[model samples]
Target: MTTDSLDLFADQPPTPPAPPDDAGAEAGDDGTLALDRYAERAYLAYAMSVVKSRALPQVEDGLKPVQRRILYAMSEMRLSSSAKHVKSARVVGDVIGKYHPHGDSSVYDAMVRVAQDFSLRYPLVDGQGNFGSRDGDSAAAMRYTECRLTPIAELLLAEIDRGTVDFIPNYDGAFEEPQLMPARLPFVLLNGASGIAVGMATEIPPHNMREVAEATCHLIRHPDAGLDDILAMLPAPDFPGGGQLISSPEAIRDAYASGRGSLRLRARWRIEELARAQWRVIVEELPHGV
Candidate 1:
């Protein structure tokens, strides 16, 4: 056939396929085939998204993106050191508007966690206003709250920001993330952690900063020391909120040995009679997440 004739046939448009009669398709007798394989793939993809993006820590940066953004935003705001305190709302707005792109609530929650003394043995932020108390009360509204970076935060976050730690692009490639918190102290041990993932979880208790530092120093001195030696040096969780760790001695030993366990914490409170027949109950210390 001639090239022109062949071209006419090749260029001919095929008829469009008929659309499905109903939005819902027929299901198999077992109702398995009706399930969208793509849906399962999509669900798994979304779960991994949460796990990778929100739940788990990336090897590159010891902190998740929210934490990275908080530190970075605090750095940019100059709230680290030698700067006036900024409103918690302002910090929250800045974090949400600039880096996190998540809900303001999540950002604020992270900010509050960093500021709360009971949460971190060495609080990263020096917070003002009703950043709540050790008595398990909710903090004042973001509008009513104020905060500034603490000296410890300055030491850990600011010192490291000055070209000490590596920075990477955030999830959207819009902001930078720290490779790791260049904390002078072993913050993870000092503050401890509690998180839940898909199939795994972590629950650690707070330790005294000074004591943990001493233990770390001891470990550095004696690299070959066993867990017993470390536990002997750093016994029990000395929470900032001053609550007693209710774990038995053996339980404490097992926790220190395996580096995991449930820790029962209580708030330390004292009562005083105020003038005019009023009683004032003051909480001196609290457990983590109180």
Candidate 2:
């Protein structure tokens, strides 16, 4: 052989193969477990819980779980529009103890929202005291406030005893709650809803009662009527706050057709003429949710 040169600096030789892995031992290690499968299942379960049981409102009744519980509890307590208003705390207690097994504040908040005219197109709870304000005021303590369901709410609960909806057992199986309310109107479109859930969300704008009623009647008369016919009766959203919907006709029509669109709403204002050729802008109405 020719004169061979010894390489002084070189990588170490590869180590011999380790002993064969024990299948049982490998399985015992957390690293080898099917983590992705378990994680996926857990994520899906939590997502469904948020979507179906909590965040989103049911299309049939337009009420979230908490809202539905509040209404049903009030109905059970005979807190009708004609009846005298009861302390909000009492209703909250009934709701928590019977139908909803949640915190007192959350239930009370939902009840307050149902009462606030600025929040709902049609106030469901006829609140006697300070429920809240459009200017960002928190509602008074539940103990201080009094509330009874409004006449509009009566429509939702009137047919409960007549088997208009199915009932299911409450959290502890101590009570039964209706699956959905027997709504006389399509409350989903009437009051509108905005909710965020797993991978999806909904933002339905409130419509005028008369327009919605007319559209409902039209649909009932002609089940297969086109969107244009329906649009003629229900032209655009009518928010609780009276403001101008400045969106063009084409945009409005597109929104109705595609089921996804944005609306441009501006506060109603007018220029007031003052002395010495001075003028000032006075805002009459604000956009909804402002």
Top-lDDT candidate index? 2
Residue-level lDDT for 73 in candidate 2: 92
Q: Give per-model TM-scores.
A: 0.71, 0.86
Full-model lDDT, candidate 2: 0.82
After superposing all C-alphas onto the true structure, candidate 2 shows an RMSD in angstroms of: 15.6
TM-score (C-alpha) between model 2 and the true structure: 0.86
Q: Which 10 consecutive residues of model 1 have the lowest summed lDDT?
A: 1-10
Candidate 1 accuracy as TM-score: 0.71
lDDT of 1 by residue, 179-235 (tens): 676666666666665554444445555677777888989988999988778878788
Pairs of residues clashing in candidate 1 = 241-285, 241-286
lDDT of each: 0.67, 0.82
Count of steric clashes across candidates, in order: 2, 0
| Candidates' RMSD to native | 15.1, 15.6
